[model samples]
Target chain A: MKKLLATILILSLVLTMAVGCTSDKVEETKSLKVTSGLWSRPEEQQFIREEILPGFEEEFNVKVELEVIDNIEKVMEAQKASDEWTTDVVMTHSGTMPLYIANEYVQPLDSVKDSLDITFMDAFESATTQDGKTYYLPISADVYLLIANQKALPYLPDGADVTKLTWEEYKDWAINIADAEGAKVSFPLMPIKASQYQVGGIGLSYGSEFPMINSPGMLSAWELLGEMVKNNAILETSFNYDNPVEQMKSEEAWLTFYHMVPVGDIYSSAPAKYVVAAAPAGPNGNGSIAGAWGVGITAGTNNKDVAEEFIKYLARPEVLYEVAAGTGGFIPPVNEVIAQLGEEPKDIIMKKGLDTLENGVVSGVPASEYTDWGAVKSVFDTVFQEMWDNDGELAKDFLDAQQKELEKLEK
Target chain B: MKNKYKKWFPYFLLTPALLYYVLFWIRPVLRAFFESMTDYDGSFSLMFFSKVINESMFTAALRNSLLFALISVMLQFTVAFMMALLLNKKFKGSNLLLFVALIPMAVPPAAVAILWKTGFSTFGWINNLLITLNLIKEPILWMTAKGYNALLFLILIDTWTVLPSVMIILLAGLQNLNKEYEEAGLIFGASRFQIIKDIIMPILKPTIITAVILRMIAAMQVWMISVMMFGYGRVPFLVERIAYYTDMVPMLKESYKMSLTYSVVVTTIVMISVMIYLRVNKKKEKEVRI
Candidate 1:
């Protein structure tokens, strides 16, 4: 009788301990779901999973469920319509923050802002802030930079510096390249993978306000593009080109103005084979489309505290620097992280990008002010197509009609 | 009681399918229709429709889509029917030929685009082959094709991709056909061409209609190849424009309504096209009866 009683007591004790352990495990394995459209390449995703998230997961006693998706905006839009939100943190392009802010899809990051010790660039900070409220924390900044194949160095127009070429000199360089070889200058003109920002950036250099269709600077930019097309100075395949990395590797395109990450990708592979420079200057100054990626917490997230902590973690100098370095050497927006970058090939390229932002007239994405930035991009596409089809003719009447269309969209 | 149960049994069996269609198909269609008409403020409006019509690429998209559908369907059907007829003959290596012909069907649209893109590139294998054959001194710039030439290029690529599926359908119809009909035409002093035209064609009308309708709908939705081949504005199609609005710029406040409106427009066009085809075919059938 005593043995039976002791067995039952011991079994109950083990059962209680098992229940306790299960509860502890459940408490310890709290998950933070982060969905980001940035750094979504397989290698980048792998780095985030293997290198970046582990420390946070271990430190916070939370499992980081990182989802790298290209259509994060669509996902957030759907989440806005729902009563429940699954995503705790969203990392996407800085331009998309306004859409979320306008719809109240994301909560203010005051806690994160207060906690961060590092200084974010003023431009990046302003991009994510509106009406005295911070919507997002800018993680990294990117600019369009000029990447030239070393083979094309000889074709540089007389007395033109490759790093500081004016718009006319740039055009002359392209013509010279085309004259020497076939048309080798390229742009990422592929639909959806467009370089309207390049056009807009050039407009800035020409002293035109961006998203303004009919300005004199814009006309000059368009006319320059037309002249290049007329001379067959642009790659014939540029209409279908997206990232010119592969083309640059193949020597199919010798010179291009492209996003810095891709320029980093090519230069890092064979730094000696290519040259990275600031975007060409015009009358205004060197013009650049300054863009950045940012992270924010969803308004409807159940894990607000954890999400805030995660944002704080992301904003840490070490984490940001590692993320920037791992993800194709993006320029970290934080000053401290920028200070830590070494003299690596990609770092050199990124430093050049920073030099452009500092020296050049930088233009923010049209989405910062325009609600229908897509429509704005479409107008650019149509006008550019017309220009290309017409052998680079600057169709002023056509530009005026499109400008009216742009104005209508604003209303 | 048994008779009533029997009467209800088919409907009882169909309940799941009915519910599936109502939930999945009908609901989304209705939702799209309503959403397209509604403004951002949830007020009823025709602004989205008008906006889509007035959109810059709308005309190009519509014209390209229609032109692609009309030309591709007719072209695909003619070529597919000819190939099907040829394969229907009991010749040596016929099965091997069919297998080889069906190989393209195995390739997905995106892969097909890549294959053709590589071939059509300036210094691609096609140019190299031409050079090797001494047919040309320099490479022909194939990717520089603009406007209609671009459209034609897409049509040819699409035809190569979808021909096998269309051919297989017609071939199945030919295989099921009675041998006695062709024998009768032969005995009646008909030429091979006359036999095909008079005896075989009438019997193959149902299959031809099926093949053409399927091809027509698929052709109407031809955007991926064009996109993969030439990107967006270079060769805009109705579905491509829809993709541009939704997939390309889903963040834009106007994108949601614009995509839905484009969807409605495309659906309407597809429905009307099929109706006209059926109506014309029915009229021909009535004439034959008379």
Candidate 2:
């Protein structure tokens, strides 16, 4: 009987410690849950853990529940059942704006604007508005760009600037490099990931819009791509966009185009190896796939005032400065923040990204391309892969099929 | 009253489990089935099913899923059975060997996929090891390995991952065997191989079938390996496509249709396969209660 009592006491103490350990989450009753989509990489770890969590907890005297969910579906049934938002705030890309509006997941920001201090960039300002009502606050700005090894530029056509190559010149230059140096130009061909994104940009250059295939310009682009593939002008390494930095470091890929996030990633590791350049202009415009990432108050929040305070706190330039430096290889959305950030050693990438952003800022719905999450990505990727497998002959029929699929989504 | 209480007691005990099954399993599956037959606005139609059937990617992925599942079951079971036999001998350090073999099962699938991918990279450990050994002049483009070789690599990697669990199932069957029959056969001058072929196999048939059926479910869901190794769009599977449609691409109606189609097809395959297996072995099952 005595031994049983002792065992019970020990077990209870162990149970108490176990329970205490799990109570590390915000214990305060007045808490806010901000579920974000930004924490995709190790880059977000330090900023989220060291800065945001503690800072928000201390300043607001409220436990901030920070969560990272990659995909958040419309919780219609739950919303209807509970009649309350489980989440207070949401952070996501410009593409989600249409879905959020359609689903009524987010509320307008007009009520919270008086507390926000920084001025927004024109594109960001326009992006955050729907029917002239601000729905969210821009967190950062980013666009895709070309990162070329300096060694590969000598192979460019006579006086053809890497940043200003025309469609014809781009093809000619890549082929020339292939013939002269026995090295194929690298392109990110991972369609499901970033390759399709680059393809969208390439299509834009040829006067095609989103799902911007099946046009004459698109034909020309594919023909060039096919020609390159046929001639073995696309390096084996270039076919993978998963690790462009490794490709650059190994010299298996001399030139590639990707989002500015990877550009900063590659630059930070080996700044001397590559140069950042604006994408070449298409027939109608510089085909930059520009988009803004932002944070908004969820419509379901019980404590709208607290949620408002958090969004306002995050919108501060210094906080955003920490974010820009912390993870995203993005340009600041605020006008003053850009000037204030200046050209510090670390800010060079941000400055470069800013310059690129200013040149080719495609605003609002058009910029997002596929609103919500475009479902045809795998299909698009597969069609391209089939083309690659078949020496890029997947031209007309494949592009047409993909274009239809994209159109279905857009509709 | 006592008799009535006894009759109702079993049901009372089963109430929690029955409730759980209804809530989590039956309801979701039924919901998905109905959703799959509907438009985004919830109007019923057969158009979605017809579209999925005709969709070239869906057909191709389904075919691949079936092929992979068949191949995985055969290879995994054979390898695992052999390993289990070796371990069942009660050799020195058999416990350590079993523990080592089970390590792969503990590692997360994502981590396993990434580890394999890194090994197969251009300047990865595999190439470095090969160079050190002077095995070949040039590195193999393992990722771009087409046709049979690609399939073989996937089979090997997958087999490596689930081999121990399959072995454990078979080992339990082997251990539970009545040794009296084998000893009796030996005393009667019967050969070792003959006893295994006739006596042991007949008894273990049910166990083997159970192991294969469980393994077949996992095999049909191959996605991460292909995605990590071959990159996007290079290789496809049914469940992978469903996830793409459901999670990555959020067209509500289409995603629902995919979920319903996937659940129905998988359930049907499992049922049909089990029925076929049982029918074939029905005669082999013996009862000696004179």
Candidate 3:
């Protein structure tokens, strides 16, 4: 009995280990493998699987398998040298699109582009095209917005419209709230949350380009943020805050700036309890980062025709609207969808984002310009830390010193 | 033929383990070493090593990792030893105490981090409790800790989560300890502290060494709790840098090489640390023998 038990245990262990070593066999069915970094939430995935892909699957008589990966570019990069292409189509964001195009991990979608009769917005068109070739077709655009609890309405600066407040007015508003209550104004300062975009948005409002590390406008932006920090206007827990929705829900933070989806999440839950508006303007204009997610075919895909068909299907006006609605609230880049938008709560939120994009000084994805955007984000994080550490008082040469660091990264 | 088969059966049993190690362990280490030494384009290059050395956070990560290992291991061993000794003694409700003490061992590192993170936030439960107790007029900004303060905060949280595991190991050792050795010390009129110092400790040396070495290695690789609590850059560690390279920016051509180099560096450090510790332990053993 002892010997039998030992043999069984060893056999079970070996079998478990062998399971991982076995290669998955390729299936012979008519299938489309779509790897997406967007719409990854469980509910969103369910909606895509049940609501969106069934129509395509039924029409083409193919099994549309949707796999949501957080960093599809890294996966594609790993698979770049391999000939066994597992992914037929990729849906990823604008920041990662540059890497795919530069590495040629994705194929040029010019044929798909020429096939479509619809007109894409000029900015979206320019973003998707590189050296006269369209790499991906833009699906939807998203921008950050200001979300405030209704309790904070009383604390708005005198004569300051919540929608049209300038940076100085916004700072004063924060200061006013901090004085009456605890520090409640927050930003998602955690590294993983792409908080650098928020900093760049402020810098753009101050008349600098996105990721202009040592630009004079960036200096002013930093100084403004430093002043807020000095006044204890920013939440002390912002460093741990990757998303302010929970804080808002807990009433730990009453005012914040965050991505449209999370903001939509807050508003959609309790529309009467919160106010959503366009991000505040700076001296130049209401500067905001306009990010878009696009769909493209991987370079090594065997099913190019199917991938192209999938992209075209994703581009339909109604299809785009459904995607925007299904994946929370993102502004569709198509003109017809924007023109035909309704008065629903989510539509209002997307309209606010579009309002900022139309009226603000819009910056393209900063990663598009830099070879190492992570390094750029590091610079911002370091400066933010220094600003916080010093009670928001920057040394005269601090920005310049950080600029030298940025230059080193560029080299 | 049956005698030969019986003689070779032991070797046959070892074959599976040997193959597992060669395939899963040796292969990855060899691959990482090879990858770290080569350039992206496959040329032999020391550029990655140079970059890692000159990297701004490299020194800080090294210092923090070493300091965390040293401090946390020493602290954990001392507290866990006391708990083990206490639990070894017969007392009422001792089993309940042991059960409560072992509760934290069941919580995973990630969950431990979240539990403490929520507690340590500015307006979190800790502050709320303090406020409710009338201990302060306002909430303290526990999350704003920087430099050594942040390191110490992580150490405290790490200690709370890992203390139970270390104590349980020590408790097992103490339970297995021979009673006659302590009885002999007691008959000689030796005090409790002296009995523990002279008799119990020397006998439990092997077990203590095992527990300390295990805890020290884990402490050296501490990254998850720090990252989960403070994010990437705030509380940088050697393994955290590896994660940053591989997880944060794997798309960069240089990130893979940099992470592999960091892995090599970390492995070298851990190996050297364990070797030095064993050498010291051997020297101490020799001294006692002399």
Candidate 4:
């Protein structure tokens, strides 16, 4: 009887201690973090460090920490886990955001829907909305175009123009440039799976949209690219090239398509800056393939309200222009704020990128996870790798087999 | 009472390790195996393994991984065995040379890879030295080399990093060897080469097999070097493909099944190899006894 009473006393004491230890600690000062895979050196990342962070800290009396996670895989893995995300908000390029939305990894911004003051372009409309919910908002624009060194401009065909050139004309121009000085054209590759994001635009010009990789239009595009490699018009797979800009400076390669951000920097370092032109026209049309980045609160975040407030603060027209200018993107949706930048001749890169965005018809498909477009991207890269291995030869049977593989992915 | 307490103490001490083994190792393996047999919504399905085999990259990844393993094992075993034979001699600075060789073993694999990358870049020492020697007017983009050339440098880098440990295993085997047999052979007027070939090699067979198998397994898992140095689709390996499916591609369920297939294939190869080695060794031992 004595032993039973003692045991009861000990159990009660332990239970009381456990309850005391479980009390929640009050969080006095609110803090939030933003993580994104879209971040790169200079421009927008710089603007975020110098302006947005300080502005938020001063205005809301809240501390904001910015993290640049270059690896999208890590960010996605975190989204897969049930634990609270390391950051309250996450951002990715428009092409990738759909996966997060489809997985329900991000919270719908329905409550602050009216607060989205910026009007997005028609192309972005599908990118931002899904199943009647706004999973992403436009932040900045990144457009791909042909950036040629001034020295190579003389080699352009007499009738051909940079603003409007057929894919064949573009090839002729590249071949002509090489013939002039025996220097190869630079075709930039991101070296890994990330190449899919950049090269998907090439397929866009061929009328290959999301889940439409195996189309005849894409076959023509890859064949043309293969011919370029065979003709030595483009850099070989084993070339001593690190980046397009560096190759341009060395006079090894003076022509290729690249994001306007790095192409604009040639002005400061070299005797002349690059001329950004629309990407070569495919059989369908010549709309520049554009990628954008935007911020959205994660569904697992506890501080949704604060994250929304921050997103709103960034979404304002004035703030957007500042960020767009810094990121060298033709600001969100449209360039309504380009005039606000006063006068900086350096804005030409953004202006040219904007011109392409404005003029060309966007032929790419809207981003959707259901398409499992990533598999299609892998298949495309595999073809190119095979071509490189076979000395620029792609067998018809191989192409057919690959297309059949892609056909199976269609919904 | 004290005797009863002592009897229970050993079991109490083993509790944490047993729990760790079950929770950390056994549970995850079981979970992965089970998950592979299910669809995304957790319904039981075995379609994924066949789907993995059908994927375009599977054949290439498996072929590359097996080829890499074969090449790496042969090169490392030859180099390490030669190194062990040399270091076993009574020579000046032998200990210091061993110390220098073992330094790579202390560094992490990722760090070692990064160091090699820095040294092999276009502007790095390797290219610069080659240029200085007039080996070639232009730099070779080592990562972009086609076919076997790209793999050649990767094998060198992997061997450089792992050679020391391989050598150590063989050296330990040499040290533990009884010198009496070699002396007996010498007394019988057996030549040095004859003694080494007929006796020393047969005696060291188990150690050689152990080192070769360990190296082979490590080689089969060759991924970071290939992925980091070359890239996706450039030099795909089995493990690298699994990473691409799991981390880069979004087909989570499909990737799980692919991994299940991958693990099964690799595990089967290792098991078969090890079994063959043991069987051969046992037969040889029986013959020697007879």
State the fnat of candidate 2 relative to the true structure: 0.36
DockQ of each: 0.38, 0.44, 0.48, 0.32
Candidate 3, A2-33: lDDT as tens digits: 99999999999999989857958744458899
* Ranking 3 against 4 by lDDT, winner: 3
Best lDDT among the predictions, by candidate number: 1
* Number of the top-ranking candidate, with TM-score as the measure: 2
Which portions of model 1 miss their true places by more than 4 Å?
A1-31, A40-74, A110-119, A130-134, A305-319, A395-400, B30-58, B89-96, B183-190, B248-258, B286-290
Candidate 2 ranges with C-alpha deviation above 4 Å: A1-29, A73-82, A150-173, A176-186, A236-246, A249-251, A282-285, A342-346, A361-373, A376-379, A394-402, B35-46, B146-149, B178-192, B231-233, B283-290
Name the best candidate (by DockQ). 3
Record all residue pairs in model 2 with backbone atoms less than 3 Å apart, i.e. clashing.
A85-A300, A205-A282
lDDT of 2 at A97: 65
Write the residue-wise lDDT of candidate 4 on B76-170 in tens digits.
Answer: 98999889988988699999998998998888777877777766765556777899999989877664565677777888889999999899999
> Which residue pairs clash in candidate 3?
none
TM-score quality measure for candidate 2: 0.88
lDDT of 3 by residue, B90-122 (tens): 899899999999999899999998898889877
TM of each candidate vs. truth: 0.86, 0.88, 0.85, 0.78
Q: lDDT values of the candidates?
A: 0.87, 0.73, 0.86, 0.71
Instruction: Compare candidates 2 and 4 on lDDT and give the better one.
Output: 2
